[model samples]
Target: MIVCVAIVGHQNNPLYIQSFTEGDDALKLHHVVHCSLDVVDERVNNPKKSGPMLNETYLGLLYPTENYKVYGYLTNTKVKFILVTTDLDIKDADVRNFFRKFHAAYVDAVSNPFHVPGKKITSKTFAERISTIVKAFGLSSAG
Candidate 1:
């Protein structure tokens, strides 16, 4: 059975989750923070020897120490999905100011109750909202 995992997040930050079954070193190490699931981690970290670059990137940030949440879940069939919400805190006044225009659109519009779990998020409203937010924050060039 093919397990599908969908990760949706705010415009400024995007999540990268790699499947261990695919044997690409560059793709595995690229933008991956950490693997919560044991099997995934073992395949990427142990056998592949991808090093601690992901953890280093995550821990090396200069942001204040706080419990910034990373969103993720495992399906009943054991497929995992993860979302990295923000690279840094949105609580900072300057950061919040930068994202103010997109705040409502993110917290309310895209993540609304109508969007069901485990489903591919293809809402035009959501996409448009993200595009507006990205442009407003000058994050169009951001990866």
Candidate 2:
């Protein structure tokens, strides 16, 4: 069975949420969201080779009014990762809508891909399209 976990935290803080599947050495996955690129990069690239290492990827989200941005990371159960960020002027509504669409597309695209692993998501058009959808959803001004 699949498990769903959600976490809520300040945009300026480190946020983490995890879920565990059932089986032998089942997936112990964790999702961490941070507001700083430097902090996230340091934690992911730290040389303290003790526990499992994470496979990382990055994405960027942009908001054109507030001069603020948000970065995200989607990691594997064995510490695999996907990182993303916004450019600037990011509004809360824009961020929320982006995740709503991004999460939907992830379930449809990534989960359905027949590749092995370590595939990077570098589609700027896709990101932009998603951003447009977010704006169309009336979330661009809700905040």
Backbone clashes, each candidate:
0, 17
Query: What is the C-alpha local distance difference test score of each model?
Result: 0.36, 0.37
RMSD of 1: 13.2
- Summing lDDT over every window of 10 consecutive residues in candidate 2, give the lowest-scoring window: 1-10
- Per-residue alpha-carbon lDDT of candidate 1 for residues 16-127, written as tens digits (9 for 90 to 100): 2222223354343223334324333343345433565433212111222133323333322333344323345333333334334434444454366786544545567755
Off by over 4 Å in 2: 1-36, 41-68, 71-94, 122-131, 134-139
True-structure RMSD, every candidate: 13.2, 15.9
Q: Against the hidden reference, what TM-scores do the models get?
A: 0.32, 0.34
Candidate 2 is scored at a TM of 0.34
List residue ranges in candidate 1 displaced over 4 A: 1-92, 98-103, 110-114, 118-120, 139-143
Query: How many Å off is the CA of 93 in candidate 2?
Result: 4.6
**Which lDDT tens digits does candidate 2 get at residues 1-143?**
11212222223232222232344321322222222344444555673444443443222331111422334434333221222322334454554544556556544444545632335333455445544554454444444
